[model samples]
Target: MESQLQQLVRHTRVHEIVGDVIRVHATGVALGDLAEVQNTDDEISLARVIALDRNLASLQVFAGGKGLSTDATVRFLGRPLDVVYSPNILGRIFRGSGEPMDGGPDLSTEPRVKVGGPTVNPVMRVMPTKMIETGIPMIDLFNCLVESQKIPIFSIAGEPHSELLARIGFQANADVLVFGGLGLIFDDYYFFRTAFEEHGVFARTVMFVNQASDPLVERLLVPDMALAVAEKFAVEENKRVLVLLTDMTAYADAMKEIGVAQERIPAVRGYMGDLYTQLAQRYEKACDFKGAGSVTILTVTTMPGDDVTHPVPDNTGYITEGQFYLHGGIIDPFGSLSRLKQHVIGKATREDHSQIMNAMVRLYSEAVEAQRKQAMAFELSPFDQKLLRFGTLFRERFMDIRISMPVTEALDLCWKTLAECFEPQELLMKQALVEKYFPKDVGPVAVNEAPIHG
Candidate 1:
């Protein structure tokens, strides 16, 4: 007869192994609990309880499920996946598993917080009304990134998406930044670290990196771990936290791969059926606390072959507030939008911000049409000549991704650009705004010398 403790322990051999998942016939197993799988050779692999039905539990092993037989033992650890959370975590780099990789001191004594926890309640969420400025002209002047807004960078392969993300991470005005890198190559990862260190923002940043060479199963955990720590800072420490996740498409790919291995029914593009819900669970973490701080999420979701209809970006568009479309190494002003921007424009910024934004984009549109006419060998009218000149100045001064300045300076530059291209009467802005902002002299007003009125 077996002892009472032996019977209660419920150690069992693996029933089946498929790809990176193992099925164990065990009782009293809960979802998300950590487990230890030991093979006949006593080699151990860490796994998590992903699905549980009746007496069978499906576990995703961090290490690939290769060379494993039915004789492998599965022992339940009786805990969910938790990551170390403390002040020390900042200025340190960690693997996707939340283990420190920066050659720094171990964070063994720090408080461990469970990853993939529930998002903040809707009742506790406050309406986002503050702008998180990144000093990028296109973002600040056109589509301002609002606090608690979840947005993605829509880009294709061979774009400078990573560089753009690094610039925001280094320049965004936030209390703390949590960066999560999923399926990034070694060069990209190095670029992010080097950029952060060189720009001197590494001290307030915590990174959870899942490199291309790391276990594919770990790619699924990076976003959750980064957001978990960010939530702790926002709710407990009362710090405004900004979470940056790069290449969520890779995360979805990992999910699809695991789904196939588990024999699950496929949805669109060979993805799981609950793809939208899965993405919402992560993006909804962006929240502004009622009386405390906020967590703003900015992610990069690559469109495979630049197809917006792809499952990953298609699903993302539904969850996020808006997207920044990156093309031709610049943020496409016409393609990008922020739904929450109206909540802060003119209220948190200068009085003329909203009007200036509308007028500049409208003229820029006309300029584009004028260029199209010019391309077809049509005779350019006097107004068309003015539009053409405006377009060139707008692209170089405002649309270019390299232009970085404060919001106030950006507003001033807008006036200068408009004044250089058109007279005050042709601007079609509000009479008072045009008279106040339109430069009196021919030369462009110095950036900070212009006086702004409410």
Candidate 2:
């Protein structure tokens, strides 16, 4: 039956072939239609129509255009790229092309859905009011991750951002997690699979990986594929889906490479002019459907040479709610901010949460100032000494990425740290909160029970 269907589709001879892209002069080809390219060697490849004119259609071949000629036959499938979506996809790993890579049964018989559609409408969105805890003090306590929020982790190259993302995937409070790894090395890909399986979250995870050795065009498809399935889970199944993409810089680089291949003019930092629009199209997919579940996006966008002004992170900062600045192996509390936290911090958490959060950050800032003063050989006051001690304890107890705890426990530790550092009158937080939540007698902070890998 499939062979008969293929025989019915008309085939057009390739008129022009660019690097990994072929132009076919056809009458009825539509944009985003899938196509099959048969090279002179009789080797077959898959492609998708990226641009369409009156009779000229440009298709991006999934397999690179290495060996081909005008003699090649291009058959348009008359449809966009799609994937088989079902509950069985929950625990599977797939290539960027959406083919199963886990040696599992084929999902061809399942219902299919098209990818790269428009984002949800504003009227259909519910304002995010719920917190998504990740069991990390830096995120859950300081910059709370809200449901349906789009945010990024800004870091430099050679960081543990991937490890951090895997930890969140394992510990995050969500019904489903879809991870898209773009341009990753084989080692990195292996690490994620091992981590997910060992942590037992693989049962709820769906991974789409585009390795460095893979064709560059597939890197462009990973995020869209992950989000398309995630949207199905969130809207149809009413499941809270969390999507994580690592090293979006690589994805942006892939886009730039493809844009250059297409002969488009470059914008800032030698990237495509439509960089912002392209990024927003993916980030805007994070939506909390009214009376349904939500989709939250937490991506890692590494800055080249640690330059935030680079086109990728610069445009991303504008679209996202806020960013997590990961520096020196920690989520910098001073650098990170969550705009939607206000919707959940005081309301969903304890009464002292907002006050305690403010007080800790304020004192940490003062402690940093005191350290600078001491470095300049300035005379130190008694309060400065207290701040110095407080800063040291804060970093050791809270700022370390390995410190994992629930929000309530983090709040308790905050009070304990403050009580040990300053007298009640010295701390300027609300008197009621201080008397209510503050520890009466300073003692040792509780020993961490969660594994460090989490």
Model 1 weakest lDDT span, ten residues long = 445-454
Clashing pairs in 2: none
Candidate 2, residues 1-454, lDDT tens digits: the string is 6665654367989988889888888866667778999988889999988877788888888988888788999887877899779999988999989999989988989998899999998999988999999989999888999999999999998778888888988899999999999999999999999999999999999999999989888899999999999999999999999999987899999988887777779988789999899899999999999989999999999998989888899999999999999988989887798999999998988889888888888898898888888778999998887787788888888877777898999999889899878888888989988889888888533332221110
Per-candidate local distance difference test: 0.89, 0.88
Q: Which residues of candidate 1, in runs, are more than 4 Å off?
A: 1-9, 443-454
Clashing pairs in 1: none
**Against the hidden reference, what TM-scores do the models get?**
0.95, 0.95
Per-residue lDDT of candidate 1, residues 321-431 (tens digit): 999999888898888989999999999999999999999999988988888877789999988877777787787787767778999999998998888778888888899
